[model samples]
Target: MFKRFQTKLLQKQVAGGYRLYTHPANASYVEKLVLSWDTRRLTQAALETLAIIAYKQPITKMSISSIRGVNSEGVVASLVLKRIVKEMGREKSPGSPILYGTSNLFLKKFGLKS
Candidate 1:
């Protein structure tokens, strides 16, 4: 479909089908100035916890807290709520603590191939 001047249309997968959105067409030829208002952010603690989970995934909460030298329960919960990390399964330890790993959303958000 067509769009306004200096803009291009792109398709994205929706629940049932594809949806079209506008994007800049003449990126190499045009210099556009716009305000930066991107919101979603992560704290230092969250970032540290995320790095640990990304590198050494399928790990338990205690393991993460032990490695980080602080309680990571809140950070992990926030990551899960953000859909970046997920519950993979339970560890075979005595308590059978839940194991956490990155979600598909994390892979896509970071542009990493599964």
Candidate 2:
């Protein structure tokens, strides 16, 4: 059983419930491993953008870019594409810019309470 799970990531769907993804091979190790079933990998930019969104939710993309001191259009778009971040609504300020926030998937993935 260990040998089978050691070489590859594993995923299984729970009966009448959500899906489960695990990496048994990293059970005893210190670092967390990304399983194969994940829809998208979290890169450095993704992580930074996610942290900003998670902390300052309902924020505008302009704010995110300002905070990061770099253009985050691609990162934010990819996060939205991955269903991790979502457009909550539009800001009441100039241009009525779109507000971004962490989604339920982000909450579950990060083990955070909504």
Candidate 3:
């Protein structure tokens, strides 16, 4: 009986998957902390790379570099480390370059519905 009750009370499914819900009091505390947390600013190159990837997702590093007129490897790596971008897949062409795209975290961070 306890197990059944716990199962019903603990989790709820959203578009992505099931998420554990916190108690109302704890939820408020966590929300406040998250709102107050300070995030480091991205570098100019990182910001430029991120913008390109966000706008033209599923794009490759070579394409980004071409558009920016500079090497974007380090910037892309930084974005990936920050969980702002992710590798989607390889492009269907010679050498099959890896494609980059924004993550779900990107949408959440930017307060996007999709």
Candidate 4:
């Protein structure tokens, strides 16, 4: 089961940072204590593309687009920028289509070892 208590505590901690309102004298202390927000957002399209890549790695962009029934070029670019995916080079075919695969970050995040 999920650890509800731990999740709640983390939420409280995140909220409490914003509630630290006091005299301007406490600015330094507040700034030091408040953690920098890490807004690591992944779009739904990118997530779907990632799932397809994870299970069917070394796949061409054309194949991915076919499976998703939509263009995944933008999503694939975002994944590459995030270091969650990498180009495994080109396919030995007519167009030499570029192949993509999950990177170490993807495996670490998904708890996959291979």
C-alpha lDDT of all candidate models, in order: 0.82, 0.82, 0.83, 0.78
Could you give candidate 1's per-residue lDDT for residues 28-95 as a string of tens digits?
A: 33323311212147799988999999999999999999999999999999888777899999998798
lDDT of 2 by residue, 3-101 (tens): 876456655667867654556555645222222236546899899999999899999988999999999999999888778899999999879999999
lDDT of 3 by residue, 6-105 (tens): 6445577999899877656466676667545432477788788888999999999999999999999998986776777999999999999999999997
Best candidate, lDDT-wise?
3
Residue 21 in candidate 1, Cα distance off native in Å: 36
- By how many angstroms RMSD does model 3 differ from the true structure? 11.3
Q: List the pairs of residues colliding in candidate 2.
A: none
Model with the higher TM-score, candidate 2 or 3: 2
Q: Give per-model TM-scores.
A: 0.64, 0.64, 0.64, 0.63
**What's the CA RMSD for each of the models?**
11.6, 11.9, 11.3, 13.1
| Worst 10 contiguous positions by lDDT, candidate 4 | 4-13
Tens digit per residue, CA lDDT, model 4, 1-114: 357444333232354463323456556665555423221466788788998998899999999999999988988987886678999999999999999999998787668897
TM-score of 4: 0.63
C-alpha lDDT (0 to 100) for residue 72 of candidate 3 = 95
CA shift of 42, model 2, Å: 0.7
Off by over 4 Å in 3: 1-40
Could you tell me which residue pairs clash in candidate 1? none
